[model samples]
Target: MAHSQTEEESDKMGQFDWFGSIGATPEAVRVLNDQPILFTILLIVLVAIILQCVLLWYIHYATLKPEQKVKKEKKKPAKK
Candidate 1:
């Protein structure tokens, strides 16, 4: 069956087309439709920042020494 021009164009949409559908703001949708590569790079940088923060936290926690318990002296019963 022959597809309409609009249908053919829609079929050629990039993988990021779904981003324009899920409650994105009009401006965001415009960017996604017009500059998909910029949107993809922005997402990559955002994810990299989040991952770097997580890795730094993991390293900070992993190298920490456990606290040593302090022994308290027991007081003798009161003298008669």
Candidate 2:
């Protein structure tokens, strides 16, 4: 007699395959599943740091002195 597929096995293969498809290791996926809150906080902190850096750069750029443009004088036409 042939062995039957279990519902749990079918569900695991259908949805969770994406983790492996995306190159996430089993351990990493397990960690993410196990501690989503910790990872969420860590992600928020990382984004905040990046945003702070970007704002600082924008501030520095905005405070820079404007470049002075030289005006060109048009030459007068010679007398006929």
Best candidate, lDDT-wise? Answer: 1
Model 2 bad stretches (over 4 Å)? 1-17, 68-80
TM-score of candidate 1 on Cα atoms, chains taken together = 0.50
TM-score of each: 0.50, 0.54
Model 1: residue 33 alpha-carbon error in angstroms: 1.0
What is the overall TM-score of model 2 with all chains considered together? Answer: 0.54
Off by over 4 Å in 1: 1-17, 68-80
Q: What would the per-residue lDDT of candidate 2 be over residues 1-80, giving only the tens digit for each residue?
A: 65455555435543334666689886666566666786679889999999999999888877877663345889999999
Model 1 clash pairs are none
Candidate No. with top TM-score: 2
